[model samples]
Target: MPRTRVHNLNISLDGYAAGEYVTLDAPIGDAGRLFAGFDGRFIHGIDKADAPVTLDRVLTSTWAQGIGAEIMGRRKFGPQTGDWPDDGWRGWWGDEPPFLTPVFVMTHHPRPPIEFANGTSFHFVGGAPREVLGLAQEAAGDLDVRLGGGPSTIRQFLDADLVDVMHLVIKPVTLGRGVSLWEGLSGVEDRFTVETIASPSGLTHQLWNRNVPA
Candidate 1:
């Protein structure tokens, strides 16, 4: 069976996944420090060896591992709201997106699927978590479905108890104002057994997995 999972989601000590004032210029807001572990060389089609060998590198390198499909909120897809500005706007990613698998973007206003040359397609849909998950699972087939999010989307799946595994990277920073990952949900930890690993780079990796049913 294909499982729903979240990987390499970075959050601050203050519980903010992303900072304030998110725009096209600042997609992640003032939380640029959250991605300090990422190597710019890999993002620019440069030599992979130029990237640093750190725990972040190891985890980020496996972001798309075995992921057949992805589901993300509209915010993560872009800074657009209400109706799309233009049909020409595919997404923040260029012609070749990192996610080669099919991606479903959650939105109230659905649109025709956008196909890219690199085997990546964006399908906009409006529905509950289970409905969307069903669509993604059908597309994923035997592989896993990843919940790529901007906090709120992940929260919906978490609230619906649809996520099988979650990998969070807790950075040592604080954004006093922003969308929080753990708001309005209390006792969420009770559902999953968490394993924490401290990295030399001062970030902590936390893995949460639901208990297997006998």
Candidate 2:
């Protein structure tokens, strides 16, 4: 069975995943420091060809590995909200999106699918988490579906108990007010078996695997 996975989801010590206000100039907004130690070049994963062997690189490499399709929130797709403008905004990645697979953007407003030559296509979808996941899984075929998110979207699927695996990088700072990753879903960790690994970069990486019933 193809699994649903989330990787490199950086959250603050205060439980915030991303900033509240995301603009075109500041993609991550005030939460830019959360990814201060991240190397954008290693998003495609590390194979000893580019970056040195490190815990971060090793883990980041798994982001694109075996991921046939991705599901992201509208905010993760762009900074626009309510209704999409006619500015012809493709995404933050321009022509070549880092994701080589089909990406399903969760949105209430629908638009035509955007295709790219680099194998990254954006399909706007409107539905419940499970329904969207089914679409991604269908597109994924024999591979796994990646829940690439902006917290709110991740929370929805998590609330539905549809996520099979998740990788959270916890930073040691507090945003105080922002898009929180855990809200209302108290004790959500009880559903998963967590393994913790602290790195020298002061980031705690938590790998969460959904518990299997006996």
Candidate 3:
């Protein structure tokens, strides 16, 4: 069975995921940019046939083998107002997006279906978190659905207890400002348990698996 997972999500030492002021140019904001690093190496590592052979192996491995579909927030998808003007804008990743599978984007605005190169397709859904996750699960088949976060989106799923697994990369830097990851996470510690903590490249990567009792 496939699980819903969040991967390579970076947070500052102060628990902020992104810095203040997010625009089309700075998607992740200031703090998040440093924590996530400018390089798209994480996605690049997955594009290869052979398994990743470096510090990014863990992330790359999950992306390559387990990913079947992707769910992202509107902000994570692109900077657009209302309905999409045209199909000219595929995504921030250009023609060859890192994801080659079906992608479900959460948005209030409606737009026609977007089909891109490879096997990527963007479907817009305007509904609750559970509804979107259900659709993503159906599309995922036997592979896990990747929860592409934009802070608020991640929090919504987390609040609903829909997230099965989360891999958080705690960057060494301190973002004194911006969106804080722990703002609404009042009960996360009681619900999720830390499974592993790896220190690769001086970055602390923490893995948490849902502890929902059957």
Candidate 4:
């Protein structure tokens, strides 16, 4: 069975994946201060890895293997409405985005297909979470579908008990307030368990696999 995996999901100590008002300038918000140690280029894995290549290895490997599709929430897509409406704007990633698979955008409003010069293609889906997940699974052939997110999307999946495996990169930085990772998870503790933990470069990478029986 193909599992749903969420990877590269970083969070701050104060519990924000991103800052308020996500403009191109302030992408991460206050969490930016906490993550100063991390090189943006390295985090994006945009280039080849050299010395202390563990971070590169982890990112490259994940981006390369076992991923067939991606699902992202609207907020992560970009600003909505205007001369360049939310639907008009492509993702922050430029002409050639790293992801080379089908990416389904979760949204309340539907839009026409937006194909990038790169292999990435964005399809907006409206309606229930189940519908979105179903579309993603169908688009993803044999490999797992990745939930590329902002916190709310992850929370929704967690709440619905849909996410199967998550690679949580807990950065050493802490944001007193911003977007939260697991803040709304008041219950459902039994739904997941930390399957593995690795510490590298002051960043704690955790793996949580869903606890439901196969």
Candidate 5:
């Protein structure tokens, strides 16, 4: 069966997934201070030689594994808002997006699909989490649907109990104020079988799998 999954989501010690003042210049905010320990391959598009074999690298390496389609919030797509001033704003990924499958961008103002040179195609839509998940699942076919997020979007799916598995990387630093991942999610751990692995880079990787009936 196809499942919904969140992979390689980095959160700070203060529970914030991304910092404030998001703009085209700094998508993740704080100049990406939270992702200091992440691999260069993710940030700078560096060669594999520069990336170490740490847990962060190892986990991120499998980011595209079995993922056939992705669903992300509008902010995760780009900094543009209020009617998309220009259709040419492809995305933060440039010409060839890393996601080689169809991507659904959650937004109130839906736009026409943008097809890229690579296999990536961005489709904009606005609906409830469950509704969006259905579209993603249909697009994913037999493969899993990846929930690419920016905290708020992931929280919505978690609240709807639509996520089947999640791999959250807990960075050691704290953002005093920003978008939090666990604000209203009290006792969320009760629904999942939690496992943790500490990496050499001082970050802790946590896997949460939804408990299944025996």
Candidate 6:
């Protein structure tokens, strides 16, 4: 069965996942400190042959494995807000995006699909979390659907009980005010089987698997 999963979401000690605002200059806003230990090169999941063996790489190595399609919010797609500009803005990624798969970007005003030479393509659509997940699942086929998020998006699916697994990277720092991942989700942990692994790098990796009854 294809599942919905979120990976590498970094949350601050204060429960904020992303900064208060995002602009062209500040992609993730003031929450950049959460990703201070991240390396973009390993985004497509790390391989031992690609880099030195480390706990960070090993944990992130699961990012791209057994994943097909990705569903993300508009913010995660870019800093654009309101109606998209007429300007030809492909994305933050250049000609080729790291996610070499079909990406469904959630938006109030849907736009034409954008395709790249690689397997990556961006489909803009608007709908409920379940409805959007259906589209991604179809595109994913036998594989799972990845919820590439910016906190709010993942919270919706999580609220709907649609997310199957999640890997949250809890950083040591704290952002006093920002978009929080745990808002209105006080008891979300009860629904999942949880495990934690703290690295010497001051990062805590948490794995949350939905507790499906046998």
Give the Cα lDDT of each candidate: 0.85, 0.91, 0.78, 0.73, 0.86, 0.89
User: If candidate 5 were superposed on the true structure by all CA atoms, what would the RMSD be?
Assistant: 2.4
Number of the predicted model whose lDDT against the real structure is largest:
2
- Once fitted onto the true fold, the runs of candidate 2 whose alpha carbons sit more than 4 angstroms away are none
Model 3 ranges with Cα > 4 A deviation: 32-39, 42-52, 83-87, 196-200
In order of TM-score, best first, we have 2, 6, 5, 1, 3, 4
TM-score of each: 0.92, 0.97, 0.87, 0.85, 0.93, 0.96
Mark the 10 consecutive residues where model 3 has the least summed lDDT.
38-47
Query: Distance (Å) between predicted and true CA of 55, model 5?
Result: 2.5
Comparing 2 with 4 on lDDT, the higher-scoring candidate is 2
Is candidate 3 or 4 superior in lDDT? 3
lDDT of 1 by residue, 1-214 (tens): 7789998889999888877677889888788887775553342233367655666677666567678999999998888789887757888888988888899999998789999988899999899999999999999999999999989899999999998999999989887878899998788888999999998878899989977766
Give the root-mean-square deviation of each candidate in angstroms. 2.4, 1.1, 2.7, 3.0, 2.4, 1.3
1-214 in candidate 2: lDDT tens per residue? 8999999999999999999779998888789878787776776757636557888878888898889999999998899999889998999998889999999999999999999999999999999999999999999999999999889999999999999999999989888988888997899999999999999777899999999978
Quote the positional error of residue 152 for candidate 3 in Å: 0.7
Among all candidates shown, the one with the greatest TM-score: 2
Candidate 1, 166: how far from true, in Å? 0.8
Model 3: lDDT to the true structure: 0.78
- The residue ranges of model 5 lying beyond 4 angstroms of the native Cα positions read 40-52
What is the Å distance of residue 142 in model 2 from its true position? 0.8
Q: What is the lDDT of residue 178 in candidate 2?
A: 84
